[model samples]
Target: MTATSVGALLLCRADPEAVRPPAHLLRERMLLLPAGTGWSVLVPEGKPWRGEPHDGPDAAPAAPAAPGGAEPVDRVMGGWATALAVGATWPVIALWWDGDRSGYTLAAGFRRPVGYVWLADGTPAGEDEAMRTFAARLSLDPVLDVQELEALTRQDPEADADARLRELLAVLTRAGVALPPGLAPGEPADRLRTAAGVHPQVERIEWAGWRDAVQVELDAVESTGLGPWVRGPRARALAAAQVAAGIPLTLWGARRRGAGWLAAGLVLLVQGALGLAYDRFRAEAERGARGGGPVW
Candidate 1:
C-alpha cells in the first residue's frame, strides 16, 4: 500500500499526459512483488508495445539495456524511457530475451521496488504472483486528483501561468542570465510592478534581480563571449545609447563629436568580443566539470 521514499521519488517523474501510466498504476504493479532486492527497467525485443499506430524500430517505447539484454543501465527508466518522456500511459514490463545469448544482463542497485516484474531474460512472466494478489488493493484516483504536473501545465499558454512560468524560470536562471523585456513577450513585468496588481512588486523585484544577474553575466561574457542573442531593435538601441551617453572621450569643438563616436564604437566592439570569448569559456568550464578535467 505504501512505497518507500525512493520509489515514490522516482515514481513522481510520471507526468499526467493521458498516454502516460498513472502513478497509482505503477504503485499497484510494485505492490505485487514479494519483498525483493534489485530495481527495474524496460526493454524491447523485435517488437514494440502491443498496439500502436507506429510499429517502427524506435517508434515504440523501450528502456536502455545490455547487449544480451540482461542488465539494465538506469533504474529510473521502466518499460520504455521514451514512453514516459513523451507521456505514454502503458505499464511496460521489463523483459529480458534470455541468458547465454550474446548480450549482457541489466542489473539494478537493489533500490526499493515499484511494481517491476523483473525481466529474468527478455521475458514477461507472472511468476511474481504477489502482483496479481495485490491487484484488488489498487484504487483509481478521482478526477479532482489532478497531480502537481497537471496543475502546473493546466493554464493557457498566454495566460497567467505563462507569466508565472516565465518568472519561475527567471528566478532560477543561472546568475548572469539576462532578462530584458525584449527576451520575453509582454509588458507584464511593468504591469506587475504596480501596487494594485494581484502580485504587486512580484515581477518588479524579479525583473530588477534578473537585470542585476544579466549584467553580471554580461560583464563575464563581455570579458569572455557568451552573451545571449536578443532580437528587438529597441533593446539593442538602448544598450548602444547607454554606451554613448556615458562620459564621452571628448577633445574640443568639432573633435568632441568625433571623440564620442569613436569611444562608443570601441565600447560596442569590446563588449561584443567579450561576449564571444565568454561563451567559449563557459562551455569549457562546463565540460571540465562534467568530464573531470582534461583527458590528455
Candidate 2:
C-alpha cells in the first residue's frame, strides 16, 4: 500500500502581520507562520474533511471538523486561501497536495480565482486558461513566465508532485517570494513546525481560543505605525477618500459574491477608520501638552 499525506501552504505577498489569520476563525488543525519576505505559510495538521462523505474507497484521511459543512481537501484549501486573500491587500496562493494529485490556486483582488492541477505522476491536468490568468494577474513577463509554466506541463512523465511544486516555485522566484528553507510541499505538520521554528522570521501562530484571539488582533492594530500620517491634514484627506471608496466597493463585492474585492474593501475601510481616529487622539494629546496638563 502507498503511504499518503496531504499538505498546504498559504503564500502571502505582504508583511507577516497582514497575513496572520485570527486564531478564533480557524479550525484546530491549522497553524500560520512566517515563511520569509512578503510571505506567510499556513500548515494544516491534516486534511479538513469536517463531517463529509469520502469520495470512494480510496479517499484521503478525514480532516478535523469545523462549523461549516465538509468538502474535499482541495476545495477546502481553495476556500480557505480565498478567504485569506479576500481579507487582505495582496494576493494569496494556496498550494496543496494529496496522495493522488496536487494543485495551486491564486486569489487576487476582485478577480475570479485561477488555478492549475497536476496528477501525482506529474501529468498536466489543468486548463491552459488558468496558466494565462495566473501570469496576467501577477504581472509576470509574458514570454518568460509563460515559457516556464508551459515547461511544467511538459515535464517528464515520471516527475512526481514534489518536482512539479519545485518547478512552480522557480517561476515565482521572480515575484519576490523566497520561501525559507525547510518549508516545502509534502512535509507533515509536525516536521513543518519543527523546521519553521528555527527560521529567523517564522512566528508560530496557534489557536488561542476566541476572546484571546480578539484581544490579540486589537492590540496589533493599535501598535501599527499610523501615528505620523494620520495626524497630518493631507493624510487625513486620503483617509477620508479611502472611506469614500471602500463603502461602494464592499457593497458591490457582497452583491456579486466577489470575495477578493470584499476583502480589499474591508481593509480600506478599517484603515481609513483608524486614520480618522488617530487624528482625533493626536489632537487631544497636543491640546493637553499646550494646556500644561499631563502630556499623554
Candidate 3:
C-alpha cells in the first residue's frame, strides 16, 4: 500500500461535547465535528502511520514517528480506538484503509475489540463471528442489521475494499452515523482532515496539559450529574483498580512497543490518578464549607 492512500476516521457513538474530553486525552491533533444525531467523528491532523508530514491547517508542530519506521494504518488506528474506548461510556469504531486493505476495529469499555478486513480487491480476510459481534456491540437491529452485515462478509465481485467500507457505513446510518461530505472511506488522510476542518461546528483537539484536562474532565462529570459518584469508597476502589491495571499494561506495551496498548495504559493511569485526586479535593472542600480547617 502506498503512503498516500492510508487514511482513518474515528467514529464515536456520542455527541461532540461528550467526546471532547477523551479526544483531548489522545493527545493527537484532530478535528472534531458532529456526525449525526448522536455520533461524533475525529479526524487526525497528522499522518503518524505513514510518518508523512501533514501540512494541514491544524497539523501538529511535529508529526510523531512510529516506533520502528512506519506502522500499518489499521494497527495504529486500532490502538488509538482501544485507547479512546477503554475509558469511555460509549463505543468507538476506527475505519482505516491502506492501499492494499481496508477494515474497521470496534472497541468498547474493557472488551476485546472485534474487526473484519477486506483486501483491496474485496476479498474477505477476517472471521464471520466478528460481524455478529460488531452488530451486537453497536446494538444494531439484530435481524435486519445482522443480515446486512453478514452479507458483506460474503463474496461480491462489485465491491472493492473501499466499497466494502462504504457499505459498512451504510449499515451504520441506521444507527445515526452520518459522515460529512468528502470524508469517504477511501479518501486519504489529508482530504479527510480538509473535509472535517471546513465543518462549521468543527473543533480542534490538542494536548492542553494535565491540569486543564483534569479540570475539563471534572467539569464534564459534574455536568453529567456524575459528581456524587466521582467520590466515596466506590469511586476510590474503581480508581485503585485502574491504577493496578495500568502499571503492568504500560510495561507490557513499552516492552512490545505497541502504541495502542501504550496509549490505553497511560489513559488508565491518568484517569486513576485524576479520580483519586478529584475525590480528595472535593472532600476537603466539603469539610472546609462545614467549618473544618481551611481547604488549602
TM-scores of the candidates are 0.19, 0.66, 0.71
Alpha-carbon shift of residue 188 in model 1 (angstroms) = 46
Q: Write the per-residue lDDT of candidate 3 for residues 102-162, one digit (tens) a residue.
A: 8999999999999988877898878999999999999999999999999999999989999
RMSD of 3: 14.1
Error of model 1, residue 169, in angstroms: 26
Q: Alpha-carbon error at 92 in model 1, in Å?
A: 17
Candidate 2: tens digits of C-alpha lDDT, residues 1-296: 12236666778777777656442355445555665566667666555543332343444555554566556556877887777677667888888776677789999866778888777778787777788788888788799988888877775876787788888888888877777777787764456656766766556565667654664564456457863454578668988999999999999899999999899899999989988887777578668868987534
Which digits, one per residue and each the tens of the lDDT, describe model 1 over residues 208-290? 24434444344443332223442124335544554454334322323656755666666665665444554456566557758
TM-score of candidate 3 to 2 decimals: 0.71
Against the hidden true structure, what lDDT does model 1 obtain? 0.28
**Candidate 1 vs candidate 3: which has greater TM-score?**
3
- Sort all candidates by TM-score, best to worst: 3, 2, 1
Which portions of model 1 show Cα errors greater than 4 Å? Answer: 1-65, 68-143, 146-229, 247-296
Candidate 2 wrong stretches, greater than 4 Å: 1-4, 21-24, 27-30, 45-47, 50-70, 207-217, 220-225, 228-296
On TM-score, the candidate that comes out on top is 3
